[model samples]
Target: MRALVLDRPGTCDTLRPAELPTPLPGPGRVRVRVEACGLNPSDYQRAAYGIPEWEWPAILGLDVVGLVDTLGEGVTAVGLGQRVAFHGDIRERGGFADYALADATVLAPVPDGLEPARAAALPSAGLTAHQAVVRRLRVGKDDTVLVTGGAGGVGGFAVQLAARAGARVIATEAAHNTDHVKRLGADAVIDFRGEDIAARVRELTDGRGVDAVVDTIGSDSATANLGLLVHGGGLAAVAGRPDLNAVAPFGLAPSVHEIALGAAYLLGDHRSRVQLSIMLAELLEMAADGRLDPMLSRTVPFEDVPGALVELSGRQVRGKIVYVAS
Candidate 1:
């Protein structure tokens, strides 16, 4: 199998193509013949900063959409030829390769009617959104939610999931992505660079602020979303941590959450894995029903991933970029 192997961690030029033996599953695992792998922020983070736990010449992708090719000991729930998707420590031989071994428990059968690229996007971002809303925040129907970077992968899914549950959502994005955010179900879209996000969210909520907020950009934007939380509201961040002092002015009983979907999945917890699997299944259903969609900005062939990673590191992408495996 051919894969993008990291000879050194920092740049695209260092990712050289190499031939390696196709990996097979071990105990309670399954080997997947990968059809697609979704590029994520974490991918570039690892590529640029270097993961200490990451082995050299390792494959760096985590999101996998593929077919079950072989089963290891104790695997019985899913059979050969079943289509599935999973996210985990592809840190050894990540999903960038044509074959990956995953714990069977980590994979969920791709729900009927879901496209592979779309399915590819669900494991990481969609699961993060689901966990934020359902597990951590427990958002309700009447909630007014605010999402920073609403046009982004996790934020985009957060917007839709919140909207689907009947929450009125407000988003802060660049002017160029304002319309895109609105189309994804935001009741109001504020251009963070130009508009006062906290103020607008306050006005939309009658100076009461929103019931929940997800800050995907983290630092600079955490204050904005924290300010928009109504007293006693919930908050979540995909990118940054909230300063408890900055959140004090809101006078709300604020609960801040950090979403580390990769680490969460890496725990190998059965309950969390099962929950994520169910969430992925429902996310796929939502996509097939048109209630959710991957804002696919680019679809490149597998070999182009190295060059694509260079762009991803610069943080200029608008939506999910999938590698269409040949």
Candidate 2:
């Protein structure tokens, strides 16, 4: 199979063409024909963070929607020709290929009425959002949640989920995305570039602060986000660790999370499968009903993966960049 393998992890061009034998399913694995794949921040982070070194010839993908072309022995759940999506195995090449094998344990039947590109965009970002709000924090009715980077991939989903869970949402975004983010169900939005996010949350909550703070962007915003949460409230940072003491002065002990997508999907149990199913159902239902929109910025052919990723590293994107396998 032709895959955009990380021949050498130096630059995007290093992710050149490579001929690798098509992968076959092991006892419980299923071989999938790649259709569409979504790029995540981790994709670039992996390359820059010195993870997928060239000597390894790694494939850079973790989430995809594809057709099950073959199934390994004893894999009784999914069948051949079934269109499904999941967080592809991290131990192997990512979704940047024509054919890749997936573990049936993490695979979910694509919800009816969902498009492959759309579905592909959900697994990584959507799963992160679901983990932070639905599983970790468990945002419930009447909760007030503040999601930083509200228009971002994970933040967009977080805003929607938190709102859908009956939480009053105050999201932080750039000036231009304020309205765009709010339509996703945020009750209020602050321009991180223009407004004081911490103060905005306080104002929205009438000095009480939000119940949970989900920061999809960190390295700069994590510490401040902690201060926006109420005492004893939770703070989930998808990017990095936050200063717990930022909320300590307020009596709030923030719970920080550094999302490990691999662990979330491969937690040797039914936990990953159950969560994957539920999030897919909710996101697909919202999309099918026009209540959810991905704000997809663009689509690139499989061959353009390298070039596309270069631009993605700029951190100027408005939404998901989908790579459609053709």
Candidate 3:
């Protein structure tokens, strides 16, 4: 099998194509003949910063859509040649290759007629947004929600989902992305670079603040947005941890949710891991029915994986990028 192998913990330039023995599935696993793989910031983050537990020579595509080629023992849930999609475990070899491995329990069937690249784009970003907006924030009718980094992969989906749920969505983006975020159903778009997000959001909501905030760009953004929540409102942090101390003086009964999408797999929690599949299934259904946009903005050939990762690392790409297998 041909794979873009990471020789060591380094930049995307270190990724090189090489021929390696195809891996066989262990019990409860299946081999995926990769059709498409989505590019994500985490791909470059892992390549550059490296995970403490991950071994060297890693493959870094996490969101995968492919056909199940071979199933291992006890893997009766999925069949050979079945098309499926899943967010791959980051600790293992990923979908930036001709083939990849996936746990049968985490495989979600890709609906027929849904493009592989579109399905591939949904596993990670879409799932994170779904978990943040739908599960954690519980955004609903008449609620006003704010999404930081609204043009980003996770943030874009969050804006759309919140809007679909009848929430008045406010999104923060650069000036250039104002129209893009608005097209994604954001009722109000704030220029994060030029304006004060909290003030703008407060003004948009008539100084009441939003009912919930989905913070995709974390660190200071998370902490600042925490103060933008109404009393009893929720803040779902996808990137970094918010400083609880920052909001202590306010007496705002704020709900803070730490969203780590991979924690379910990392903790060896079978139930939560299975929930990944369930989430992907629902997301796929939404995409198939035209209710959700996968927002796949670019599709490149398989060999462009490394360059695409480099591009993704630059943080200028507006939407999801997927590399299709030839």
Candidate 4:
């Protein structure tokens, strides 16, 4: 099998194509013949900053949409040739190759109408959004929620999921993405480049601030989102951690949460894995029924993985980019 392997943690140039043996399923695991894999922030993050746990010549990718080629012993829930999507572990084998190994317990069966690329896009970003908005923040119908970077992958899904739950969502995005955010169900869009996000939220909420905030950009944006919440509201961040002092000035006493979907799926407890599988299944069903779009931005063949990594690292992408397995 051909795969893009990182000889050592470095730039995109370090990711080189090479012939490698296909991974086989172990006990409680399954070998998937990968059809499509989604590019995520973590992929480039590992490339830029080395992951100590990932050995050299590693295949780095997370989301996998493929067919179950072989099953390990003790796995009877899914059968051979069954279409499934799963969260690949970079610490083990990943989806950048022709075949990847995954724990059968975390696999979700893909519905008939969902394409491989779209299904591949859902596991990481969609699951993160679901966990952040639905579980961590506990957004309700009458609540006003603000999503930072609402036009991007996780943010887009957050907007949709929050909207689906009947929350009035406000999103921070580029002026060009106004319609994009609105289509994802944002009740209002703030042009982050030109507008004051916290001020806008205050104005939109009649100086009361939002009931919850899903912060995807992190850094200063996460700190800013902490201040934009109503007193005693909730917050979730995908990238940055909130400063205790920053939240102190709000008088809101917001409950801060860090959303780490990758860790939960790859290294979490049994209950976490069950919740991830259930969310992936629900997301797959929604995509199959045309209720959710994975927001597929582009599809590239496997050979172009290096260039794609560079492009993704530049960080201008609006939605998910998928790689079709060769």
Candidate 5:
């Protein structure tokens, strides 16, 4: 199998093309013949600073859409040749090659007529947004929700899902993506580069603050958003950890939800891992019916994975990028 192999943790230059033995599925796993793999910021992060549980010579492409070639022993849910998409576990070698392995529990069949590249864009980002908005925040009708990075992969879906749930969606993006995020169901778009996001959200909510905030761009953004929520409102963080202490003095009773889609695999949380597949199925159905957009902005040939990682690491990508198998 031809794979972009990472022998050591470093920059994108550390990735090199090599013909490696194709991986086979072990018990309770499935081997997918790679069709498309999506690029994500986490890909570059893992490549540059390795995961604590990951081994050397890793392959890093997390959002994978492909056909199941073989099923390991005791796997009864999926069968051979079924087209599937899943968020590849980063602790294992990922989908950046001709064949990739996954636990069968995580596979969701790609809806008919959905393009592989489009499906490839969904699993990780879509799952995160779904879990944050639907499961954690429970965004509902007439509620005002704020989504940071609104034009981004996860934020785009968060906007749509919140809107579909009858919530008024507020999103933050670069000035240029204001129109794009609006089309994705964001009722208001704030330009984080130039505008005061907190002030704008207050204005939009008439000084009440949002019912909940889905924070995709974490770090300081997460902590800042805590102050923009109504008392008892939720904030779901997908990226970095937010300082809960920031809201301590206010006694806002803010609901802080930590969303880590891959943590289910890391902590051996079987129930949450199973819910990932359910979330993928629901997301794929929405995409197939046009209720959700994969937000795929670019499709490149598989060999461009290395350069694509470099491009993604730059943090200028507005939407998802998927690389198809040659």
Candidate 6:
């Protein structure tokens, strides 16, 4: 297997080509021949954060759509050659290669209408959005919800899902993406670059703040965005850095939640794994029916993985970027 391995945490140069042995499934796992993989923010963050425990030459991709090559002992759900999509196992080699390992508990069959690149795009972003808006916040009819970074991958999905749940969806994005965000089902789009987001939200809601907020953009602005939520409202943020000091002064006393799909998938417990699998299946079904769109931005050949990482680091992509296996 030829893989783009990260020798250490640093620039794109850290990713170099090397021939490694193909991984075989261990007990309760599956070996998937990679067909397509999605590049995610977490992939770059894992390298940039340079966590002390991370091993050198690590494979960093997360979302994979591939064909099952073999199954490990105790696995009975899928057979060889079935097209599947799942969260790629975090290890020495990942979906950036020709093959990757996956836990059988997380694998979901690719439905008829979903393309491999689109399927690859769904795992991380789709699961994050679903868990944050639908599960954690319990957004529903008549609820006013604000989603930041609304044109980005997870934020776009959050907008769609919240609108689908009948929430009055308000999203913040660059002025150029106003129409793009609106097409994704946002009831109103705020130009984060030129407008006061909190003021706009207050105006939209008749001087009351939103019922909940999903923050995909983590920064000082994200902390202030929390002030846009009504008292006792909720927040589900993907970014961990928020100014905790601002929480109470807002007088909202909001419930804060973080979306950690990878942590739950890697929990190695049967119940957690089963719950993730079910959620993945439901998301895939929605994608197949065209009710949910992964919003694939571009698909490049596997050789472009390293360069794609560089481009993704700039944060210019509006939606998912996929690597199609040769």
Top candidate when judged by lDDT against the true structure: 3
Best by TM-score: 3
lDDT (CA) for every model shown?
0.82, 0.79, 0.90, 0.87, 0.90, 0.85
Q: What digit string (tens of lDDT, one per residue) describes model 3 on residues 1-326?
A: 99999888889978998888899999999999999999999899988877767656788899999999999999898888999999988888899899999988899999999999999999889999999999888899979998988899999999999999999999999999999999999998999889988788878888999899899887788998888888899999899988989887659989989889888788858889899999999999999999999998989996788888888888889989998999
Between candidates 1 and 4, the lDDT winner: 4
Better of 1 and 3 by lDDT: 3
Q: Write the per-residue lDDT of candidate 1 for residues 145-240, one digit (tens) a residue.
A: 988788888899889888888898888889998888888899899888887776777678788888898888867677656767777888888787
Worst 10 residues of 1 by lDDT: 260-269
Order of all candidates by lDDT, from best down to worst?
A: 3, 5, 4, 6, 1, 2
Per-residue lDDT of model 5, residues 126-145, tens digit only: 99999999999999997999
lDDT of 2 at 182: 82
Error of 3 at 43 (Å): 0.5
Model 2 agreement with the true structure over 1-326: per-residue lDDT tens digits: 98887755466656888788888789988899999999877788777644532336788887788899998999988888998888755667788889877778778777677888887888888888888998789999979988888888899989988988888888888888888888889988898888777777777778988788888877468887776666678878788787665554635656666665666544645676656656665666677677767667788997788888887788777779889988
Per-residue lDDT of 201-305 in model 6, one digit per residue for the tens? 989999999998889887675688777878888888887656767866647788888787766644656777777778888999999998988899899986788
Regions more than 4 Å wrong, model 3: 52-55
Q: Kindly indicate the candidate among 1 and 4 with the higher TM-score.
A: 4
Which residue pairs collide in model 6, if any?
none
For each candidate, give its TM-score against the true structure.
0.94, 0.91, 0.98, 0.96, 0.97, 0.94
Task: Write down the worst ten-residue block by lDDT for model 5.
Answer: 49-58
Candidate 6, 223: how far from true, in Å?
2.2
